[model samples]
Target: MEVTDVNNVKIYNLSCGKTFPDWLPDRKKRQLLKKEPSLKRRIELIQDFEMPQLCNTINLSSNGEYIFACGVYKPTMRCYDLNNLSMKFERCFDSEIIKCKPLSDDYTKLVFMFCDRYVEFHSQSGRYYRLRIPKFGRDLDYHPPNCDLFFVGDTSDIIRLNLEKGQFLNPYQGSSTSFNCCKVNPFHHLLVCGSTDGQVEAWDPRIRERVGSLDCALSALTVDPQGIPAIRSIAFKDGVNLAVGTETGLVLLYDLRANKPYYTKDHMYGLPIKSVVFHQEWVISMDSKVVKIWDRETGKPFTSVQSQYDLNDLCLVPETGMFFLACENQKIQSFFIPSMGPAPKWCSFLDSIVEELEEDQDDAIYDDYKFVTTKDLEEIGLNHLIGTNLLRSYMHGFFIDHRLYNKAKATSNPFAYERYKKKKIAEAMEAASGDRVKLQPKLPKVNQELAKKLYDLELSGDGSRKAKQTVALLKDERFKSLFENEDFQIEQDD
Candidate 1:
């Protein structure tokens, strides 16, 4: 199916089964008048949101319920509630905001970076902390599970900060030029940074050392021999593949195991890529001219939408397959893309029922006994084997089936009796076949004196007749024959 935009509406070219009937009214008919479910097309407007200031960066909460945006010109940070489609709060900053990110999963705290080398931290309760750093950070990323720590990339270095202690840690230095972007791979626990020298470097934060690096310049064409294209944006797929965007309007896909980019594409818009987002099967890249979605496997453009204003950032809501773009015109636009595979069944009806029941719970009697599904157990953090079994027994009045109890008891032994039993059986089989060895083979010991002489001669670089005679004495026929005779006698006894 092809989805296109016409007069601010999305026109979907859908296929119905049968053709239209002759009696259909032309004025009342849709774009495709079909009587027997033939091919048809229709227009739809899914969703949209407005912004009060031009947003340079946008971040969505884990639950996809709140949006945090900050930008320059107005230098304001604002939060929007997706459910109500309204602004929650707006806070103005002194310097132009370069980036805004939530400090935690619950969104209780937030971090903002300003163009004037100031980093600000704010909480939901209106408490805030501002720190002046050595240089302006171009990009920032929080530690996956630790809200107290974050990494910021600046010109020539990446710095780590501890918010809880209000202290700066040792800076990770490697980039020869300014860093344009940085990201943390939660799955692999890697810190990645993109530099103006057209290099992407991955660091092992635990060791405080550089682990992997890639030169993005090789992926793009160069006109000036000395000029290096700046890496503008970066995104990762499953912690194994990295997508890098450069100032030369080229997107390079690099496999973490390979030293070079596996795929490269010169963007059709030919503008610097402001942001890149990796969907399940598509790579969504946006810049000043347009937002383009490319087939991830083929590295070909699947679809693109032209924008009148420059796009600053793009975010994807994985749960709904919806994408949001923060633009230069003080607007946030959203679009829905159909999944490449069969869509999963949504539980909206069940969710609505639960919400309704939750609202009137006070009127209902609290039942001591309740039927619990697997999902309920998971929600309450009882999905493990022991927890699940305990919950099952409790819900069933502490009575478990005899067979299941026995199975669980057998499997729960810490010594792993099952493996022990298999090992014993294998040993017995070997004995029955008379294939077991009565004695273990011994490894030959090194000749220390001869080895020392050879080492000394090699280091001395002496190739004289005296050194040759000494080497021949070390390989004396009588001594070699004595060792060989012992080995032959041992093999004969076996």
Candidate 2:
């Protein structure tokens, strides 16, 4: 028996639960009858590994071979092989793990940050060392060119450390507010830090000063009534555009050329945005319950999936188009995102109509005006000699009358007359030597005695009060020359 769809087309074989198009050729129909299911799913959850405690953070190696995860409830760090989906190693920590980072692309050495103001260095060769810091470090990032140098951001400043010598380097002051996250621009080698005050500051480590800064609160179109939302997560796209997530669940994409965000999406309502990842042309934002994928170019949400656990961190494998989500429920979930294939049916249809309209427009004929030649002008009925003489006389008379009218008008106004005289003098000077007119410098008109008096007042113990008094005195026309360079004395005398 054949089943018909809503469009009244035969699409299904009810007896065998098979589906085939009515336009299928006999040879293709036989092949379809022998073939297996063609409706294969695109995304599949490969493995979901549960840990002993809730994992709060996760980092993948640059080579995309291993994963490093840490938990707050349990003071332990674990490494897992991405290919085999098995735990490679696990080490117990003295305190709760705040963050973890792989030291190299091979994942041989690892750095772990703890809440007890200590950073631990562990290597595959069974070597380890612990360094105590003054304040609790919130985020850690390694310099792209030099892996031996890493930066840690705390409440008030960012500290640079040398991993080779296990010593601290120069410390760079960041925002007055506490830092919540930090990242290093792989292309520019600049350190970027996000603070609890909703500000992102980019510092050049060589000069150790802030080069650029943007306030997330100011870029928002609508302010969150509660308060200034803190920047919780940040990701870079193309090393120039930055994607920042706020506590109020807003994702803002900032182009380096402009101070404001180029695109803003309210991904979640009230929940804090936990993680943001940029892969290819897709931007993934995760909150407590949902993971949203957005088209980076258009800022339109492509798809959203509901999750059972609260996601903490997300990492994408560049080699394969797969991404991993570290959840608060101690499970790391993997998902495969397929590429954007053919255009949608509606889009293709609209494009076809546009193409047809463009073709129709190309076939249209238009008339453009061309320049008239001398022969055509003569053909219109005037002798060439008489027309040429008449045109020259008309041009000469027009310029002569215009010059006379301007001279008459200038004579009526004293300022205009003086300006006209000066212009004529400049023109004569230029014609004489082909040199531009030079401007004369004015002599300094500052009163030495008044300046000395003001300087002595500022040097006095009551400088603040005397400075206020001096400002008030300078407001008077008689004493204004002490502060201004203008020759007001000549104007007053006139």
Candidate 3:
């Protein structure tokens, strides 16, 4: 017994799912109900900016206004404007940036840890100051309460930089265990450091010494005869429970009260666990090979994705499903797991964008012309029209008119109709540009006196009302005329 769909008079497997029917009058209504917002949107949020090569680290500011990313290939740091969905600015450094962190809420104050055993402080405009560290820094975490920065590196000690005093403080020395990463628990005075010797150390910043350590790889299901797996990442769940990711791709959940791990989960791939995040109800771990999410308590597998890119780092907008991954070969990519949490207050439109994506059938955007590869050209029976102006040659393919696909195929001449096709393409471009375009170049409408007044007012940071009044007076219709008005006098130069 077959049942009909909600759509009326179903043609039984019509092309409506792939393309809007030509005879259909209400295409949007058919798609409206199917596009209801759900908690399963996991598509990449495309941002408008140029991406850097080998993005090694990423960080979100305390406020959701900006996102920062660093790439080692060119030793450059890129900041994205989340509010406008565009790039704010990019800065180049002398050495490869191991990690980038924001110290200020709005991303105005930032610190870039470089591989050259030095850290540079960058303000909103440019470099403010720099300090040389003892060892090469791997990662860093900022403690906002005390205005301190905890840095982990190739050494056993956790170096501290007193941001307020602008000097290096006493180091948090631990056993001869090289540290990989450090994270400060927001709910407590505890700071956790993941070591290269498969140990996660707990330190009390007030006492400035080691408190406790959890061995993540001890008594494991499958013991590696070579050596113990290194602890690569650590995330504090609360004041007690902690999440630790290891080099062997295992995530160990620990109860700070006990020595043994409460729950140990594996990613099964022997890759180094680069990041571990504790989202609502689930524990997310990324090991470059894949990203796995599992239940927090029972360790039941929720979902896993094979992100084959060279994932070097991961950053999450805490409390939300939104997280970003940094790759070595590709640009930083962001994913929103709608089921975990709703989009933040600043980016509420993400819900509608995801819903709209559901109604879109084709991956390519609708435009005046569409890119067609060799196979597409063959399928459309226009392979012989390759060299003609009707098919504009681009990278590895040609762009053909989307509306006149049939007409483009009818133009079988590879050479004879070149001049005619060129004229038609030019005409189409002119029509798209419209009549507002002028034939001659024109200058911007800027009055010299108004611009001078505004500039002086900005530099002085005074008299807002005076600047506005000056602009209003300069923009008067009488003064703007070619002939000077009697009310405005111009001094004659000798």
Candidate 4:
């Protein structure tokens, strides 16, 4: 549905199901219950300074206060302030910092990993040391036990490393598989690892042997909220439940203790479930490109948002309710969980559709047209349908009062008349606007940015004044030199 923002009038395109569901009350009743949040919150673009020589991957600190962005090129590490959205500091590393995690107690100590499977221990003060592992490292996590070691998961094996000793030990060598993710158990000596083969296996680093194993089968697995490894990446909240994100973007929260899943919510599309986290109140998942949050206890889907890019790494910052979305492009996007006070406007729309469908006793007649609505045409908007002249038949249809097979003869260019109508309307509007707009002396365009800026300023309330100022400014030899620059030129053909 196309929802217009009364503030700015910019409309957003949304799917029908998104704004309307099959279980809600009538539209009037739904509208009375809640109002749509206005489109006042446009995306504010932050200027990126201290540009990396080459961008790779990005991660945020556990507290969401700092961002650690790394690039494949030299000068690998760059740190930015999450609050102000600006680069606060930067450091050049020997190689790209593929991943970084800060110790809970000491913010100075950071575990940095590189693409070459090399890891380094560095202090915020610039002192650093490296740990060497034979197998290439794919992902790693710190083992919180008193053993003072970090567990590193690679494509084929799991390894244990003592950061202080720079020593490494492989707990699982031959069982090596395409490992994807891993976590250290809270109360046990077992380290859980997930693989592409859909297996979640536990290994006792002390004995260097496998203890428990479960087939997650393309399921992003995590130890359940109850601290058990029943499935991969699926977790529990109240001691008997399980929450899992599947490869098909179906997030399931089950009550294993009850031998049943509490509920399941399919993401709008099929996206490879990348990660899942069970907070005390929410079951969150990173699937394909969206961050999905659901109710932990009820298993009801709450809300979802695309993280602005393909998310490769993700984690939630405890206590603050903030989350970090890390992209392979070396940019980390941090977002805060908005309070669950008023639901989105689309929620109300869905509720209305559902209620109407239930109230209709003769639902079969309208079953095929259930998806149809006036909002559909408005949502597609004039811009997208402008160039494509098929809107008449595709976006609308003519009704016939005749019986049986009475029909309008199909025309090759059914929307041709509609296209002409719209074109004439646009030309009339353009001509009306041209009456007051005075043409300016064209200058060679120096750059797109400058051209756009000048256009915008001239289009502002004081176009004549701005035009005169531009003409005077262009008379300067320095300004004329800009036109001669290799970057600037306006085609005379126009």
Candidate 5:
């Protein structure tokens, strides 16, 4: 997918036809519909509120059933009930509501912080309480499975609050960098916090001291499966890993036990990630109107949302598999995650090859290759190489070059490569033992019809002359004759 700016608005250009699986019988859906009418794609405008005040920060409740938004000029917090998309305007003494969370069983009760210095709790029973502490707070996380408490932190210290008793415990002391994010381990008493100065500090609230520390922060923080701060925004099959969003719009996931990140993607957006969240399966982040949801395991974004304003906060409500998005424009939107059905059954042969390629690439400095499926190669006239021993040699050479080689991974259910493997071994043994090494045969040359069609593209009196340069890239070398006229001209039935 590519984003291009025309005039002042950004237009998303999707290259849906450019895919690796070109061989399946019914796979070329987009290409088959070439002459069909174009479809207009528009973002769903769920709801909008014109708040001239303009908000800079937003937060959602733990369960994602309520929205809390605040801006610089606004003196009070705005609360929106998600039960029926209703809203209530409430006044507050706090200068700014920077963070908020649900404190009790009833969704009506809430706890929000003002200027990171004061914590205010408004109970459903019409009672309110405020607590002032020495350090400021950045993020609030409520812990459930282990302790009946919540955690918040500033630059140098973290505060643990017992919500049931409405009390604050001794502050957990740590580094001096301001904390940018924090999360509680639901299965343990550990509290993890990431600092603006690139430090991750982990502490057990019961011990009231620091237990572990790592470097790198300013993105999202989460505990891994071992209940360690090894990963960030994404979850893995064995453990939770950290998905670090840098200022350059690159997303990376680091395993806690490893010193380096496992995967990295330059998402190419120019906005800083304000908040990142992960469900059991996906990682979600904010980037203007497009809320990108990436598969935690694959590091690929499968879906996104298009909007007019930047998304400041996002949360996944696991009970319903629905997502709540709180925009900087003070409007909250919720959408159901399209059911992806079940995990598609994969051919073990292809799956193994793909995994091997990924691992080899990660461990070595090989070039990246764009591989096409057997069907695609066949259409381009390269199919005979599939089962030849020469092909295995070619794959070995490809591995030596460290390029991607998952061509047959998604095809033919069982991905039967045994036939091809035997052929390749025979050819390789014959060649390796000093017999003549026959180079792979080339495909039939490009036809005159296709060349003329390409040439017409050059002189069609349209703005496609630039396209002609790429037509030269057609795989069939024999097609070049169509360009005989060098400077072809149009003739009106002459």
Candidate 6:
């Protein structure tokens, strides 16, 4: 127990862990084991706000008061008030908004980098100023230290613009032609850019050329069929440590003092790593597949979360474990990972909420339920199990109460679905039964012309063949059944 003598006050915190057995039988010694074998990462869903379209990027204001989500459907952008957790307003654009950054401390002053060769400055009222670049802007960054706007894109150089004098400053020549991501390190005040040619280049404004780690982060990709890898995201833990994410699902940590990387980690999904950031003691990375939080020292995954849809980007909520994720579902998802850290000061109430969640027992949404489709019943031989305790029907599927999915899959025929399909085709070929539902069961498709001709022959219509066609069809045994069968004959009434 920890005690604080603030003013000769003896206050006890019952929440602190005690060395006594509370949940055990009295007078008996039983080692209190962990309720779970692994870390119980209770990542709660905090927000699922709707967006205009696919949220290509997400950014928060310098004060963490507002969030901006933009995408390419109509080249639209939506702003949300973080304090109230409600959307403030939406603004549409002519060009695709690929990147966004806050020029000033608040959301009122914002600059957007378009897919075309344009950069637009916007305020709460409307557009304030506009600037044109030589090449299409891929990413944007703002350096408060120099009060300059950094733009990287299709060209082989980084553009520096002065906001005070409204003029373009000198550019930093890079090793690659196209740059994808740009950032300014808070500790070193160095400008870093991730390029399309898989190089993470850093620059000092005072120098004409690059200064920091000019190494390729995609050097470890050895898969034969995989193509070239490009750097997609870059994050800074400190001035010395840099985390680089590539399009080929690789993350490299580089120490600025050396040319070599400290270590390299792969996401294993073979997808483009969308975002990678350092939070507390963990390195969080998100791909198109899943979000992974791993240890900074051991490089082992702490926990993972599978996104509901393909992810486009991720932004770490400032000074908190909560994060906002942008995806194609026209909605942004935010999850609070308790292990990352506690809630921020603005929302300290979440700490008790998390504690309550830890002690609370959660029931499955579908308890003892298994979802089985129409094909699953036939393939898994669950017809007999439906009415019994083994299976229960719900919605459009069956739930297994007695047998597990693995056991059923092991017992049922793996080729049952194929056999069932063949049997269905054979039944369809044979005319449907008379008692078949009045709605008319579907039959195998045949030539409409041939069916019409057969019907004409049955009725002795004008189209009935008189010589060669009649003789040829009559000799075929297949036609004999069609002509003689009462089911095939068209009858208007009884």
Q: Quick one: best TM-score, which candidate? A: 6
lDDT of 4: 0.53
Question: With candidate 5 superimposed using the best TM-score fit, by how many Å does residue 138's alpha carbon deviate from the native?
Answer: 1.7
Q: Model 2: runs farther than 4 Å from truth?
A: 1-48, 144-154, 221-223, 340-494
Q: What lDDT tens digits, residue by residue, belong to model 1 across residues 1-494?
A: 23455434342232112333458777546655544233443212222234555777789887667888776565777787766656788788778888888876645788888788888888987648888878777888887544335445556768778665678887788756678888888797788888888888888877778997987776565432345788899998887988999887788888899977777777755678888888777888878788777788888667776656777788767644456677876556655444322211231232343345447655543343344455544444434644444444555333334454445545555456655776677667767967655453332344444445565564344455877766564467756643344442333235
- After superposing all C-alphas onto the true structure, candidate 4 shows an RMSD in angstroms of 23.0
> What clash pairs does model 1 have?
16-37, 16-38, 17-37, 18-36, 18-37, 18-38, 20-35
Q: Sort by lDDT, best first.
A: 3, 6, 1, 2, 4, 5
TM-score of 5: 0.50
Clashing pairs in 6: none
- Model 4, span 2-65: residue lDDT tens: 3323222222223111223336569754684366443222222223522344344555565556
Q: Under the 3 Å rule for N, CA and C atoms, how many clashes does model 6 have?
A: 0
What is candidate 1's CA lDDT for residue 457? Answer: 60
Compared with the true structure, the alpha-carbon lDDT of candidate 6 equals 0.72
What are the lDDT figures for the candidates, one per model?
A: 0.66, 0.65, 0.72, 0.53, 0.52, 0.72
Q: Write the per-residue lDDT of candidate 3 for residues 78-163, one digit (tens) a residue.
A: 88888777788889999988888887787688888888888999898899998899888888998887888998988888898898
Root mean square deviation (Cα) for candidate 2: 35.9
TM-score of 2: 0.58
Query: What lDDT tens digits, residue by residue, belong to model 5 across residues 1-494?
Result: 23333323222322211222336456455554463333222222222321325564555565555656555455556665655455555545536767667665545777777774877778765438777756676667776643444444545666667666656666667674456677665555466676655566777766566877655432323221211122222222233466655443556666767656676655556455655666667676665556676787787666666666666666555444355555655334445432322111211132343345447655444235443455555553546666654333334231211121343433532434664665577667756876666454333243445555655554333333467565554545674443444344334467
Query: Can you write out model 6's per-residue Cα lDDT over 84-103, one digit (the tens) per residue?
Result: 65678888989888888888
Clashes of each: 7, 0, 0, 21, 14, 0
Which parts of model 1 have CA positions greater than 4 angstroms off? 1-48, 145-154, 222-226, 339-494
Model 2: per-residue lDDT, tens digit, 1-494?
A: 12223222112221222344557788986776566544221111223344566777778787767878777555767777756656777777668877888877866888878888888878896438888877788788888554435445556768778665667876777764688888888888878888888898898876778998998887753645678888888888766889998988989988977888878888656787878878678788888777787888898767665557777777666634346677766556654333422222212332343345447654442222222334433443322434443322332221113343344345545476565666677667658865756554332356545555655454332324546778456446886664476554334235
After superposition, candidate 6 runs with Cα above 4 Å error: 1-48, 221-228, 362-494
Pairing residues by index, what is the TM-score of model 4? Answer: 0.50
Cα distance off (Å), candidate 2, residue 244: 0.8
- By TM-score, highest first, what's the ranking? 6, 3, 1, 2, 4, 5
